[model samples]
Target: MQLDSQLDSETGNELLRQAWVQFSGAESYTDYCQYWLELMCTRIGGVTMATLVLDSGENGFLPSAIWPEKSQPDEEFTALIEEGIEEASGLVHSLASGSYGVAFPIRLDDELAGVVALSLNVPHIVLPEVMEQIQWGSAWIELLVRRQRGKEQTEQFDRLSGAVDLLAAVLSEARFQPSALRFVNELAAAYGCDRVSFGLTKSRQTEVTALSHSAQFGKKMNLIRRLSGVMDEAILQRGVISYNAAATDESQLVMREHAQFSQSGGNANILTIPLHSGDDYFGAVTLERPVGQAFDEQEQGRICSIVALSSEVLRNKQNQDSSWYQHLYRSTKTQLQRLFGAGYLGRKLILTSIALVCLFFTFATGTYRVAADSVLEGEVRRAVVAPFEGYLDDAQVKAGDRVSAGQEMSRLDDRDLTLEKLGYLSEGAKLQRQYEEAVANRDRAEAKILQAQLEQNLAQLNLIESQLQRTRLKAPFDGLVVSGDLSQRLGSAVEQGEVLFEVAPLERYRVILWIDEHRMADIDNGQQGRLILNSLPEQSFAFSVSQVTPVTEARDGGNYFRVEAQLQDISPGLRPGMEGVGKVEIDDRRLIWIWSYPLIQWVKLKLWSWIP
Candidate 1:
């Protein structure tokens, strides 16, 4: 009896040691229960199958894990196990009524959580002690389940935290697409996925711009085209599609189409997630896994979070791009306006202020020229008055006629002058005949000498008479007859130096502006300006600083300086004495300081004078 007792104790201890090893080796609740069920089946000699069912309380017993002799359990068996927990125990008892089987309840911290069932194909004896061991093993499995769940939760939290960090980096940096793509690719690789693709929706069409991707199978081009074609529809729908462990029929088709396809590959799966910012669906991320390798809902949810963060980064980048473009556009427009004097930068107040500060001491002295309007007049224009007191006989030109130097404009009535010239010619002819006779006879030496002198005198008289016949008024140079209209003044005899006509050079012209002395301080030589003619209001002619007279003439209750601007390009119909207004550009300043600059200058000057 002692020897038998020792052997029983040794056997019991060994059995317990084997059971502990199996229970401790389990990595998760499912593995632990599977091992425990297998151990029970092994202990029962006639057992055919064993299974661990989780109790749903009011729902039923759901098949958690099983070990079968010939094949895996069928859907019918699984359904039976999923029946209500109270009914499940009865159903199993009835199924094994004539056979050898036992159903043990598994308790987790004193609450019945599940049932472990073992079926024997034939009747067999089960020791009471062995039943206790089975019960104890089931309890230990429950504890492992809870511990495994805690570890999974902890790991998931860490993964999500890392994803959040990546998102923060993407949003903060300027160029984030590359970094985002790299991070996503790393995620795909970690999950053992074959390929990863990222796309963004285009505005005008059902297309997308492929942002980034990992390896593309041989059908990469075709896949890209197809994805791009469906982008609009996907964005509008904002849905996700996941294929876990591809169907056998579909796998065949995929293998034929994809170049990198393998038959022995892990479970083929595809997951797509939409990235959104507010109401806008930016795009989607696609993850591809090989056969037998797939992601669960938890993994998919984590990927969705990453997609959402990437969308925000893309939105910010687009906004930055738009802002930069707007700034560049405005800067370019301002520069062009400055280059071509077309807009407000060509205003008068700004230009005049600029000229004064640079060209004159008015800004320093607190005194500036005032502005005025006056009829433009020039000192260079001189009236071409009649030189000799005579009538404007035979007026050949009108008031507006253009003439050249030495061109006859009119002829004087020289009838009396012609008669005097004829008499002188007749006397010269008589003296020439007498001198010829004395020379031919060679008589009286003194008479011959006198005849020779008379011939010389007659020759001089003829030359003088010819010149008197050619006296007709002519233009001195190419000019316009501006002043006296010979048509109205014809035959009107006037004293010498009396104004008959005024002529001015055709091309030469100036703008004689009556710049107020207050503003004249800025007007100086070499300042640029623009002239707007009253006659030609539509045209603005360019001119530059030619002369700024120092003396100010009193006009319109103010001292005004005569500013003369030289025209650069002469327009049609421009002549001397044409009326026009001109703006002289002195300097350029910031748009903000135009009005205050003059006041500031005045105040500074006053302060300086007071201090001195």
Candidate 2:
């Protein structure tokens, strides 16, 4: 038995340590209490079940946590407590004839806050030593509850500190509506209120701009309004107010009205606490309890503490906002004075003159000209290809060599052509002899007719010889020979019409400008512009917009319109296929209007819709 007692002591101490850790780790007081009751029932062997009943004042003993209660306490259990039975006098009682149980009152300081009831299965085994251990465990549980309360108080203080810091930040900055509202919402949730709201006095009207509520209560805007009204009244009176009642009591007519309001939205018990800072009031926090529950003094004190913290924060925030506005006004006034001073005005005039001078220089110098980068191109040019199917002879002009119009670019082998020409000449000579004989024998009737036929054959042979003389390929215009080389490509067999050389004109060039779609509307046909070539950047040439294509094409994921500009002053070195940028002098508008045109259009559209 002595060994058993020692074991019991060790077990109790361990359980106490575990309960202490759990309670300290608890996020909230309600959670701590629930964990404590569950741990106690689990640790003690004989105790088949346990429960915690909190004192609800006039609401009587309210069941908070229960392990194995078969049925809920009805009016009879409430009557037993109300009648003040001696067995219920902060002591243990036996529920069954042979079963023993213990009841310990949970107190804050000396006042009874709640009761913990534990029951054992067998009465015969109810040793004094075991009872003592159970009592010791209950004491530790009570200490844990007290520590949990202290932790809650610390957390509440921390929350208030955070709210103050947030309020201070909001006051220092004028645009703090969002941060302020968030702070108020978080505070209300931390305090376990059914609904919390903050009303800021705006133009002589109290507008509840922020609100929050417990998860058990659904979102109902009317409850928020009612609570706001209560707080507003309290703030006007400059004090705190609270309401608590049974759901159906006549003495709680206000509570009944609220309860009815809540029932319509599926909520029941309700409490509202007004918040005040010094003599002034800012808002109120309201809490709703589920059915058959009421707020006691401890809960009321907690709610009041939260409201008090919020009220002070709101007042500080208001003062900060006022100071911020004052500072901003003073700073703005000082800036305005400096901006309108004579020195500033003179500077502005000088700057405007400089800007105008710069703009004039840009236009006069043709610095904004369109001079496209270009490669050598042909003008009225054609490729000197093989005229007839033949082997190529030595080419007269190589690639990049300049050739005059009608110059021989390349020649056919001409050996075969020469032979054919000679053959045609020989045939013509023979036919001519035959024709002479026929003329001499003109008197010989039928012989003269044969000679006439031979004369026709001679004429045809001469025509063939003339056609062979024109078969050599030649340049079509005065240009550079951009394509074939004589030394490299000679003796190569070529077909008729195959390209041997490309000739390009030496003098004229055009600028193809890529104008962005955004600036396309500002461009006009025939607008005078300047061209700047990358190759000859030092020289800017004047030009005029010759053509503006209405259709837009995609380039690099953006739309651009093709614009053609003709150079007014032709440079000697300029050639076809050169490229450059073209800056057309479109109609000028005010700088401000150009920048804000899109925003103005959007606002106009919005206002037009608003009018309807």
**How close to the true structure is residue 513 of candidate 1, measured as C-alpha lDDT?**
74
| 590 Cα displacement, candidate 1 (Å) | 4.0
* Candidate 2: segments with Cα more than 4 A from true spot: 1-379, 443-468, 482-488, 514-525, 547-554, 558-563, 592-612
Clashes of each: 24, 22
User: What's the residue-level lDDT of 14 in candidate 2?
Assistant: 87
Q: What residue runs in model 1 are displaced by over 4 Å at the alpha carbon?
A: 1-387, 404-406, 441-470, 496-499, 591-593, 596-612
Query: Relative to the true structure, how large is the alpha-carbon lDDT of every model?
Result: 0.61, 0.61
Question: What TM-score fits each model?
Answer: 0.35, 0.39
Model 1 CA lDDT for position 500: 60
**Candidate 1 lDDT tens digits, 1-612:** 999999987886776568568866877666777677666665544566677777544675566678863357544444444452444333334352455455666767666677766555653344444457666676666766566657778867866785777666555556545555555665565566676666665554433333345432343565565554334344555666565545434321222212222233322566666667655566766667766666777777777766665666765665465567776885786566565645555565577788776655433433222233533333355465555555556777756778888788776556666776677677767777776787677767856676776777677666656544444767767888876666766666767667666667767666677886656667778777677777877987777767877767876676788767677767657766677677777675543355556688789889999995
